[model samples]
Target: MVRVATLLLLRHGRTTANADGGLAGRQPVELDETGRAQATAVGERLRSVPLAAVVTSPLIRCRQTLDLALPQAEPVVAEGLIECGYGSWEGQPLKKLAKEPLWPVVQQHPSAAVFPEGESMAAMSARAVAAVRAWDARITAEHGPEAVWLACSHGDVIKAIVADALGVHLDLFQRIVVDPASVTAIRYTPLRPFLVRLNDTGGDLSGLVPPPRKRRRRAARTTDSDAAVGGGAGAAR
Candidate 1:
């Protein structure tokens, strides 16, 4: 069984559309002042970690977020990580969209929700999950299993990725909340992917780093991919 790299899913900060209560959906919406601040704050929190790679959605908002958050890193744009296509719904107010007949299906039955002349919610989840897993494997192979990477994406995309890691059904993904600028961490093993952190807005990230090579080798001998019997002692400080 091959060890996989840790994936850091970062939802882009709030955009102008978000502030105005509209759905940005694949629009070229940029970040607002508050969003820039959020990106800066998250950057400070991640400044110390040595990230092996940085990937981002092709959306402008996501690129803007990564610009402010990790300006020193070169992030690759992944089409699979882009926002879900909302078609005619793009740029519409959330309040107005909620009144549409399709809204209920989106909230309660996302697996079956397909936008008018746009992509299906299930399709979005599938592509996002596939992109993340493929990247994780590639990073692990190239940079070793201890590699840590980041992916800047939209809220729904991150939520879908998180749901997949948790083994939750796509229909129930609405229950997951991925706040703007929040970071979610997942570690994939041969057996399963572990959700280490979820919706973390302002948390110490030093704990996410793996132990030294010698210590890691020793720890590997004592533990498998299986979860701790009773939530075993957390990551090494």
Candidate 2:
């Protein structure tokens, strides 16, 4: 297996619902004008960097962000890298749903929350880890001893990926508050993953190195499929 040079994970740019404070899980919203600009800025800042591949979730917002952020490099859509399905909450307002007496219970026991008949955090976390692991494996195989990767995903999914990789408890999900367009860097040795940076969207890549050469790859398209996987063998999808 080959080793990766660096892995940069980016949350998608802002969306209409993001501006509206909507839950947006499985919402399939695209970037508004402002969001496009944000993505454009991110791409400009990262324009000089090289990425062997740009992996993204299959959501419209994620694809749009990658389109804007990696203007030159095309993205490859990976189902494992997609956002957590909110299930019954896909298009509903959480403010109203929280009215359920079990809302607190659901928050506390996300694994059993059921999202009012939807998926659970345990399930969401499983597939996300699988996706990252799959990507990590490919990074080793294709990029040689030193390859770089960029994943454009969602807040909940990325957090789950982080928590799982760092061995954090699944129940305490709020340990990290990932903002839109924030860039987080985590390094994985062949054995364990080492989080090199977190929430570094403020333009700090201090210990990070960009691609050694300016390169380009074919872009991947975005989709709005609403199906989801269980994410792993340990949890129910």
**5-109 per-residue lDDT for model 1 (tens digits):** 788999999889999999999989999999999999999999978999999999998899999999999999899999999899999999999999999999999
Clashing pairs in 1: none
Question: TM-score: which candidate is best?
Answer: 1
TM-scores, all candidates, are 0.95, 0.81
CA lDDT, candidate 1, residue 190: 84
Cα RMSD (angstroms) for every candidate in the order listed: 1.9, 11.7
Clashing pairs in 2: 74-218, 74-219, 127-231, 230-237
Candidate number achieving the greatest lDDT relative to the actual structure: 1
Candidate 2, position 8, lDDT: 84
**lDDT by residue (tens digit), candidate 2, 1-237:** 223556788988888888876778887788888888888877766764567778888989998898778867788888887777666766656787677775786567666655556677778889888887778777768875356678999998888877876778777766777778888877666556766667666673433653334333445221112112553232112
Model 2 has an lDDT value of 0.72
Clashes of each: 0, 4
